[model samples]
Target chain A: MCDSCGCNITPGNRHLVAEGEPGHQAIDVLQHLLSANDHAAAHNREHFDRHGVLAYNLMSSPGAGKTALLEATLQALAGEFRIAVIEGDLETENDAERIRRHGVPAIQISTGSACHLDAHMVHHALHDLDLDAIDLLFIENVGNLVCPASFDLGQHRNLTLLSVPEGDDKPAKYPVMFRAADAVVFTKTDLLPVFDDFSIERATRYLRELASAAPVLNASVRSAQGLAAWLDWLRDDMRALRARIAGGEAVRPAVQPDGAALHAAESAA
Target chain B: MHELSVCQALVEQVVRVAREHGAGSVARVTIGVGALSGTEPALLRQAYPIACAGTPAEGSTLEINERPIRVRCALCGAETDARANRLLCGACGDWHTQLLSGDELLLEQVELAKLAEAI
Candidate 1:
């Protein structure tokens, strides 16, 4: 039977079957599925630079304490850095509410069924938040280590978290996320003594293998251990972003009386 | 889980490719699913149809080529296919094995057909 017309067709005209019709020609296409997401992410990066906001995309598995780390970060850096958050979740605005309680502006982007937050969604959330007023922007990506690694959220840096309870083999199991991350945070260190699953040496070795130069920070948000170091790293990042802005290395928004800067000024007033 | 999200990306890529080549519809998309890529082929298959809905590649078939995880043992000069759940080299009981393949998630090729011309 012919693939095209379901008739008993010979092999000589099988090209037609492959083509589907007489005029129909088959074209070979080789492309990456993440191309669109990558393009959008680049645009988002430009948007962040224009507003002088240094964005960080945070990724981790559920119960990796990403929210807790953010909470502690918000508390520690509130006075020093003008921070804002865009929280992504499968459901609920709970994470956003938590961040908002810290007095920092936050917007919840509920993906509903989506596993990861792509660049387009982040772009929309940026409009709602006063980007100019924000020195640092943290995008708490949906708590899935696997899918989020494939999609770039247009952030300047990507941070992946792994908790002690999740075991030390995560870096080896989920290499893509570890390889893509600018930094890896080992969260829930306070529980390390209780759990035989986590191994610092093994995890560190695996992380180094996947991401050679990526910094790994071990922290326990519950105990406030290593929180200062995390904040210090953030401060350094913000300082570098500010320097880039001041040196005209970054794209600055056009000075209109009605743009983001004006909006931020008005809000401050 | 996350495989569903990846399937969505795959569908979008197929549709975009079909449109670019003036293809009426996509027939098949050949993707390379690596063993250590952490994507489940079954879950991806389940998600493909839902993701392709309302897209140009709606009825296209997803052909996944599962790439075996190949690793080189550090202790011994032997390369072997590593198991998905276990990283140990079959040739030698060595934990220090460098991965050679099976981490890629690529849409290697897309087959599309143009519409028939009106007689």
Candidate 2:
């Protein structure tokens, strides 16, 4: 029997069944799966513009303290910035609930078995939020460091987080996320004294070498250490985003070709 | 993990392409999985069938070509295939080499058979 169609066939049959056809054929496809996500991301950017929201896509590993950073960020900036959050997870709404505790409007996107959040998911999440009331929108993408880097959530800035416990070699291990990031935040600095493996110097050097002049901030939400600098950078970024939008600039920065060296290095294994 | 997400996107694209080309079923879909793109081709293949369910590409075959990492050596000014485990130059053993290829996830082509032509 043919496994694909469950049709009985003799062993001497000349035609062997294939998954898609009777025989295998190679097609020279040169398209990117992210192309669909990219198109939807562009539309998402336009939608954000119409509502006057500055979105920031946050990327990090599972235990990198992304939600904690958001909680602290909302508490500190809430008086000034009308912050909202869209949390992506494979299962729970725990992160979204945590952000909501800060009194900011928050939405949780459960991607089911998928590991990353695409632009279409963000578009759907946006429809549920009151865009007019949102000033600074934060999207905490799924925890994996790899896939989220390939997706753009229509954010004005992309922030990648790495906790101290994750080690200084993260920039070397996950270069593409670091390269695409507008700013890299080193979280869980409060644990630095406890772990000898954490080296700020090594992390800084590697990040500078990979990102070439991108900003790196070490922060700990528990102690509020370095949180001020983080908030200040966000303020500056949001201000600039506002200026650009007001100037009628496009929602996103200029699109560089995917073949750029920086992108290649970061996305490279 | 991420392969599952990529697989889902792949199925959606194959369906769209098949419909546009007026094909009843997809014959083949070619995708380039760059060596440095952080995608595991084996994992993508394992997840492809599950992600393709209920789509036009349900039984379609996913052809993934493994792309080698290409890098430009900083010391020798030469471009060569890079070793995935180490970013060092293939010829000079320089760690400061700049990467050139193997970070792309490109969909190269799609083959579909016309409904009337299918045996």
Candidate 3:
């Protein structure tokens, strides 16, 4: 106890020796550290909804065929629905350039050293495109399986790709990323015949271990085996989103529950 | 790896709070770090000082409360604590589980310094 005003002394605030005597005030902030990003994400989501755009956040390790899959998806859907892409990388417009070649609007977010694309970056890119002109929007996050999964980015669905060469154990090793996925895709599946080490069954088992019931689809831009399923899935989501919007409601993806509370859509609603 | 940026945001919030309360300096800040939050606590701890440099919270202490993962079973409607990697419900071994409260990067409280009391 202090000789003067008896301020409660505890191990946590012991270092505040000067203030331990009295006049110490503790404020309950009760705020999420990711609140800013989440608010931006919610705003971005609203933009997508207002324009009736279906957004997807695509994440994976480097060279995991995100751009390649986007190229293939664009080729498949460009004729039916107007598409746009926001490509994220440490530093490069290469992915955006590739998407633009498909005659679709593509905005590039160069994060410099950031490992993931946050909502603010996506919001900035969102302004560059005519949201009404877009039917489907893909945000290709920086090639990272770890951090990208943690951010919302206002996507209606989160897709994490695990290529065949990357091995089936990826779902086991990165449980958080796989767990956050609305759907996990096995990219570069054409090489499965060559690589004996990769097994779709084992990968599915590992994903199930995380208690994730996310659909795991196979895809190969080169061979186009699962290409139809991918397109069909997009169409299904578009139809679902339309239904939700018609009922005066919006759709939210399965956000990692803890961080979900911080998003503006829920908080303000 | 994003811990540094996380810490930076944390410090910014703390400093903002201190300024808002007209505090001369900040004494301590507490945060909850969850297992599934995708942020490494050790890395966050190491990055705190760097983030707080030259701010009102310069010499403040950061208390990290490591939270455990908990999941709610869709089948059984039970909420149970589980490991980070394995999120199955403890009540029943069901594959359908909804995470209740594991991934939390939350700023809980901030202690601000005031005038010393007269002894």
TM-score of 1: 0.75
- Candidate 1: stretches off by over 4 Å: A1-24, A239-269, B20-22, B33-38, B53-56, B65-104, B115-119
Please list, in the order the candidates appear, how each scores on TM-score for chain B only. 0.89, 0.88, 0.92
User: Is 1 or 3 the stronger prediction by TM-score?
Assistant: 3
User: What is the C-alpha local distance difference test score of each model?
Assistant: 0.74, 0.76, 0.84
Rank all candidate structures by their TM-score, best first, as comma-separated numbers: 3, 2, 1
List of clashing residue pairs for candidate 1: none
- Is candidate 1 or 2 superior in lDDT? 2
TM-score for candidate 2: 0.79
Query: CA lDDT of A180 in candidate 2?
Result: 65
- Model with the higher lDDT, candidate 2 or 3: 3
Writing each residue's lDDT as its tens digit, candidate 3 over A158-188 gives 8889999998889878888888888889999
Worst 10 residues of 3 chain A by lDDT: A12-21
Please give, for residues B1-119, the per-residue lDDT of candidate 1 as tens digits.
Answer: 67776787788777777777777777767777775566778888899999988887888878777777887877796888766445556687566666667766677777675654222
Best by DockQ: 3
- DockQ class, candidate 2: acceptable
By DockQ, the better pick of 1 and 3 is: 3
